[model samples]
Target: MEKSTHEPTADEKYEVSSSLEKGTNADNGDTRFIKSPEERKLVKKINWVFMPLVIMILFVQFIDKSTLTVSALFGIYEDTGITHDEFGWLGSLFYIGYLAIQLPNQYLLQRVPISKYLGVILMIWGVTLGCHALGRNFAELAGLRFLLGFWEGCTYPAIFLLISTLYRRSEQVIWFGTMFATNAAAICIGSIIAYGIGHMDGHLNIRAWKWAMIIFGIVTFFLGFPFYLFLADKPKSRWFRLTPEEEKIVDERTRDNAVVQNREIKRDHILEALKEPRLYCFFFCSLFLNLQNGAISTFASQIINRMGFSSLTSVILNIPYGASIVLFVAIATVLSHRFQEIGIIAIISCILPLLGAILLLVLPLGPVQLLGLYLSTTSPAYTLLQTYISSNVGGYTKKIFYTSANIVAFCLGNFVGPIMMVGHTAPRYTPAMIGFIVADFLTALMFLYVRWSQNKENNRRKHLEEKGLISPPPPNRELLDLTDKEDLSYRYRL
Candidate 1:
């Protein structure tokens, strides 16, 4: 039989409609609807199925991205004979593609099946990473890195969008924290794996760095199959096979979220998002934080090595760095959960890294400096930045545009970060240290603006509330896909 050619309608493609059916109350905006025993069970199943898949994808994909860092540990420089200048270019090229593609990605996000899109890109980048082992010169390596980065660009926004659509704001914080914490897991695991692979040098006449790339590539490619087969692409999913009653719960959750998932790319949403100061605040905050991240993550192994440890020993030392990431991210997550404050948590996250940069600058190189290095930067702020977007932004088009701009900041910071590793700053990397201090400080400042802006709006909305409860959403606002700006009743999350 010929394949069915029918395209699913908007109602069919977007499974969770805001307008409710039997037993599901449309007006229950702030209150959760999963009160029944069966409904609770369904919620658990949703969490169970989605969490591991998202986390594992994060773990492997991160390792794949950091393959260049890991390869540096195992003599990629000597093997390829690329100069420091070329090396910086190699690092920048990936993010260049990453930034280059996001404009198109903004549209494709609304047009495509994100799960399948992410899965396909995962496999493609896997192959690209594997091919990195074959690169003998700067040009080859640069091309492959660009391709890998170009494909990997889809990951964050797609995952961010997925989490926002799949769960309500209350549940989103956990997933966001867990998803980013997986970066630390990947670092630690990749470090351990690299430590072992480092020992395998000359086995089959293959260098350890090559082996690292090959192994990471194979694992990444295989991971795509499961994600494509199982991940829920939309709010209503074939994977969930949710019953009508269960579907109602999902719909209610989506209605409460107020960020409708549909194929339509409304021009006004994009225009509205562009005008919002908070949008620039989100992207620039990310750019500044990642400036430190891009520089530090690329050169972390080198920094440890310069502190008088062996290459393999530096690989071991990264475990502690990974530990620091987990600890800080955990604290940020818990505080956000406890206090429901985004601004303060973001500021706190930057302060650690600011201090870390200062320590790296002032103190003599040793364990203290290493401790500073670990504390100097972690991803709690970046994680919270993503959470801020998902929670606060409402229109589908605006959210994607906000997410895309954030990705651009991510790419730009990372692009310039590796360039800071120029040889003149050896022994101390003093310039990079100063760069971190300045960038992280800026990030903290921007988030302050974010919090103040949000607070002002949230406070204004309080007057609209009825007897201390949040005001009911304007009629059919959820179905209309109104932006937070358009919907006066939609409160800005802290």
Candidate 2:
């Protein structure tokens, strides 16, 4: 894509220059602060206070969402009299609800306390999940699924906002990896739970699938209260007991990363974000990658069952699938941290899934097909994409808008994914696997485009700086809540 050739308007130039002058004055002292032992201690303290709650909530969320897929093997469809196509609609409609609330959810994230907001929604969704136990027909189940999606929509945006607010850009990838790795852990744990629950078909005079929904929902519902009480909204929140000097250090660290903790929605940031090429690149990449996710997440167990494994054995096999996700996510995160190249890591992750798709398409239905399915669990790419959004986007509103837009695209892809695999394509699902290959390749292409665009913009900034055509950015630019396009010195991380 062609780079934008328009220069900054005079008003924009003056605003940046003034902000730079003020920041220069404020940070006039030597700004080269090394990471001291105290900073490490602060980080450790922050991790202890923050990471656990977020990880737990995210794990529960994934498990709750995965219930439909797991329960399918144990007779959700058979008991409810839902046809195969109707089952696919259940997956798609959930995303419809998810997509419907994204814009409002983004606005809420900006104006409300994220932890409190998420907690409320989590409780609501938990109730919705539990209500799935009473779903006697397709309509009832679909309604519950839609409501579940609506409430759970708050989760990713809130978590992304929290990570961006709390961690530095360099630290975000690992944290994202850690948070998403819980999905894998959830799968492992959830499978074991499902295997055990599958045997309780007649207990309580309820179907085993109903038991799974009720039990998981109850657990999810109770956990929300703790998140409400304990999760810190930001560094300046009174919940964290930091000395004045420690607060100052925290402020400086955030400024160094060029991210401001701004709450008011900025129309300019939204407009600017709408015009950025990278935004669309990221959005489309997320869309395509998650298409594969929609199919695999909803049907992996069923696929295993079709391979001659009993339903119980299929549920148990998800442990290995979950392990692969954890392993790849960890390795990809470590690579991104060491190299500081999220784009490259993301591309590599995409390729793994594409290869998996090929195996699913071409290999005979057996161990190799299963191997391909497991390999295709490229959820690490989604984690990296979240890291990219949190790290590269500047201005709170723009960040919110960008992430929300990406989620909308994510919902669309998921909505379309399962529809592509109807009853006719059951065993091999050749066409669906082919679609996965196409989506994976396109996603990788988009990632490369995003990398190129960021590098291009970075080079343009460097060239302009060398020419002395623009004033150097102030150290406190982050405080201004300027969009990356508005901040001349802002460089995109690849």
Instruction: Estimate the Cα RMSD of every predicted model relative to the unseen true structure.
Output: 7.5, 8.9
> Total backbone clashes of model 2?
0
lDDT of each residue in 1-494, candidate 2, tens digit only: 99999998644543433232222111111123345565667777788888899898889989998899888887898889999889888888889888988989988888888778877777888888999999999999999998888888788878888888788777888999998799899999999999999999889799899999999999989888988887888887666677655576577567755667667888888889888888888888888988888888888888888888888999999999999999999999999887777888899899989998888878887766788888987588888998889878888888889889889988998888878778888887888888889888888888888888777777787779779987977866667888777887766778
Backbone clash count for every predicted candidate, in the order shown:
2, 0
Tens-place lDDT digits, model 1, residues 1-494:
99999987655543433332344112212333335564566778788877788888889878888878878878789989987668777878889989878988888989988878878888988899999999998899999999988988888888898898888886777778888789988889889999999999889999999999999999999999988888877877877878766776676677667788889989998898888898888888888888788877887888898888999999999999988898889889888866666678888888988898888888887666797889866599998999899888888888888888889999998998888867777767788788888888888889989888777776666555645556566656668888888776776667
The list of candidate 2 runs beyond 4 A from truth reads: 1-34
lDDT assessment of candidate 1: 0.82
| Local error of candidate 1 at residue 169 (angstroms) | 0.8
Using TM-score as the measure, which candidate wins? Answer: 2
Task: Please report how far candidate 1 places residue 267 from its true position, in Å.
Answer: 0.9
Give candidate 1's error at residue 355 in angstroms. Answer: 0.7
Clashing pairs in 1: 353-376, 356-376
How high is the lDDT of residue 333 in model 1? 89
Estimate the TM-score for candidate 1. 0.91
Prediction 2 global C-alpha lDDT: 0.83
